[model samples]
Target chain A: MPNPTAAMLVIGDEILSGRTRDANMHHLAGRLTEHGIDLKEVRVVADDPRAIQEAVKALAGAYDHLFTSGGIGPTHDDITAENVAAAFGLPIGVRDDARAILEAHYEKQGLEINEARLRMARVPEGATLIDNPVSGAPGFTLENVHVMAGVPKIFEAMVEGLLPTLTGGQPVVSQTLRVERGEGDIAGPLGALAERYDALSFGSYPFIVNGRFGVNVVIRGQDEAEVTRAMQDLEKAFPA
Target chain B: MPNPTAAMLVIGDEILSGRTRDANMHHLAGRLTEHGIDLKEVRVVADDPRAIQEAVKALAGAYDHLFTSGGIGPTHDDITAENVAAAFGLPIGVRDDARAILEAHYEKQGLEINEARLRMARVPEGATLIDNPVSGAPGFTLENVHVMAGVPKIFEAMVEGLLPTLTGGQPVVSQTLRVERGEGDIAGPLGALAERYDALSFGSYPFIVNGRFGVNVVIRGQDEAEVTRAMQDLEKAFPA
Candidate 1:
């Protein structure tokens, strides 16, 4: 069976403004890959409601799952949850269950559940909560879209808890054979090998070692047997 | 006037598959920000022709400038050049000017300008070349889109050469005030300050230090005076 496809939507102005280097996309990409989910595309947009809603609608409709990071905190910029809810035309407000989670956590810490703090409890109707083990706030899952915090620690934790619940196909496997030759020298045989193995995908990356650049040709596919066979052929084509 | 808007398209299967971590997006974001060009959106798509072409057409049309990285090399997987041309209804082949540059580079390196190597010389019709100082292969610019190498060093060089040619608006000025309080505590006043300054943008990021998390509120705008005034107001609201 084909792998379940996914897309990521990263919403933040700080990222686009170059103040914060986005760590979530790479982290999510690695996690999703291991879980047998194919991450097809990623879109990073600024902190505008319309922009967020539009991206949510488009990505949610296109992929099997759409995971979003950032803009779910308790600040003026934390507009992702509401915008996501708006995208699906769902009514959103402070839900009793979410409020209960925040209330219990705040009570344990001897802190007041102020209005701004309570903003974290605002979830769309009919959305289930994704536990944030690192912090008190909870993320939400509405339809196939998962909304999580922007913080790396919290986002990673949410993904770990979330992936096991979803169905995924066979995890893709890859093998790389380093050729101590220029990409130009490797391209001909590699291209021919790619054509022979239509089930696999090839990627040629050039890198420098001891001041001499060489190509690392990688073979990837869902079937491990096919991947191994292709790797064997690639090694034969460019014998070290 | 507003800054010239821009978007980035990252074309690579390796990045989407998590075999490679993308450094170009963050690097491009920093460069575009410093150049006074507003980066509004960024999309990372797999190395598929339809995916590449669709993303190219959408981003290039929506933004004033579109910068693409990856898929221009001497490999079967490097299909970005032709796909981008197809998106614009332009014919593509090995143009004389691009071919001459490749030949000269190869002659200097004492390497034969073989067919695979010559693939780097393919240029779309009417597109101008963007110099790749780090490597011999040249990138190209068609309409508002600038296609460049995926390698970090080569992409950086191409961006450096390309930025000086395009017109940019006033450089965005920013100020950050760190508060040793939770984002919930900081949100009310920060949201109010954000409302007071209609032209500026506010971003509140929560960070951990010594086992305690604090909020760092960033204020950004094109006008230095307005940004400074807003910063002053923010400091007054959260006096240390």
Candidate 2:
């Protein structure tokens, strides 16, 4: 079977303005890849209902799985659940299951589940809750979309809870070779070699580390043999 | 005047899969601060056209300005321009201005502008081009959205070209103080200080660098004096 495709939606205002550098996208992406899912895309949208709704609907339809982080807090900007509900054409209201979770949480801590805290109880209809053991507020999954907290710690916990159920494919393996050459110099030859190895995916990332023009060539594929062949060809093309 | 709002769309498969750790969003966010534009949202979508279209439309409507990076390149996955045009219900064709820019670039390098290279000329109708002096394939600004190359160097150059032309508010002045405390420990007092300064924005980014918990408290506002005052209060609340 083909690799299951996934996309991530990072929803927050804190991340975009350089106020926060996101660790969630990187963490989730690595996890997804290791689980044998091809993470095809990610979109970082602000805490806007419309933006979240539109992104949720589009991504949910396109990929096998869609994951979202952020806008699930107790703050005014936390509108991810409502937007996801709107995207699914479902009503937004406090779910008893979610409320039970939050109620128990606040009760244990001797904290009030006030209007602000109770807001976390709101969940989309027919969505199954993804348990957040770290914090009281539960992450939820509906159809292909998994909506989790923007907080890195909470997000990781939910993914750990959900990974076991996923039917992952053969693990996608990769090999990287560093070449001291400009992308423009290597583009044509690399493109030709990439074409020659149709089974393996080739990527060229150029960087200037310590004032030297260097390119990191990555070859990825599900099949180990095909990846090996591609690596051999790459070595022949640019020998050390 | 209030701070100008902005959004970013990072379009790439590599970023989501952990193949690339994105630098563009962080770079753009910091630069936006200098221009007094509050980058309120960031979405990293894949190379998928549908994903790109949805993200672009949503951000363009919500934010004062939107910046998109990645997929505006010379590869099969480079569909940002086409998808962006579709989002706005605009026509995309090989634009004359873009063609002229690419032609000049190729002419200088004595390289042929092949069918593959010519793909860069396709741009949305009614979009003004943003010059990329490094690569010479001009990025375009359509409506409130700025589409630029995904390559870090190219993206940086394009942002530099566009920032001076944008209508920005007073540059947001910021001061950061380092406190060796966990976020939970500091969350209460910090929230109170933030409430006191209604005009200024304060954020606490807690990290465990070298096995010691430290929270970097940042205050942002137009007035340097106000920002300084808030910082002083923060210091008093959580002294060294």
Query: Which candidate leads in lDDT?
Result: 1
Across A102-211, the per-residue lDDT of candidate 1 in tens digits comes to: 98987887888998989999999999999987778999999999999998888999999898999988888989998888888888888999999999988999876665
Candidate 2 deviates by what RMSD?
A: 5.2
Over the stretch B1-240, how does candidate 1's per-residue lDDT look in tens digits?
A: 788999999999888888888999999888888889999999999989999999999999999999999999999999999999999999999988888988888788898888898899999999999997766899999999999999888898899999999998888889999999888888888898899898998889998777677888899988899999999999999998
Candidate topping DockQ: 1
Clashing pairs in 1: none
Every candidate's chain B TM-score: 0.97, 0.94
Best by TM-score: 1
The DockQ-derived docking category for candidate 2 is: acceptable
What is the alpha-carbon lDDT of model 2 when measured against the actual structure?
0.82
Every candidate's TM-score, chain A alone? 0.97, 0.93
Model 1 stretches astray by more than 4 angstroms: A209-211
TM-score to true structure, per model: 0.98, 0.74
Q: What share of the true interface contacts does each candidate keep?
A: 0.80, 0.42
Q: How well does candidate 1 score on lDDT at residue A93?
A: 98
TM-score (C-alpha) between model 1 and the true structure? 0.98
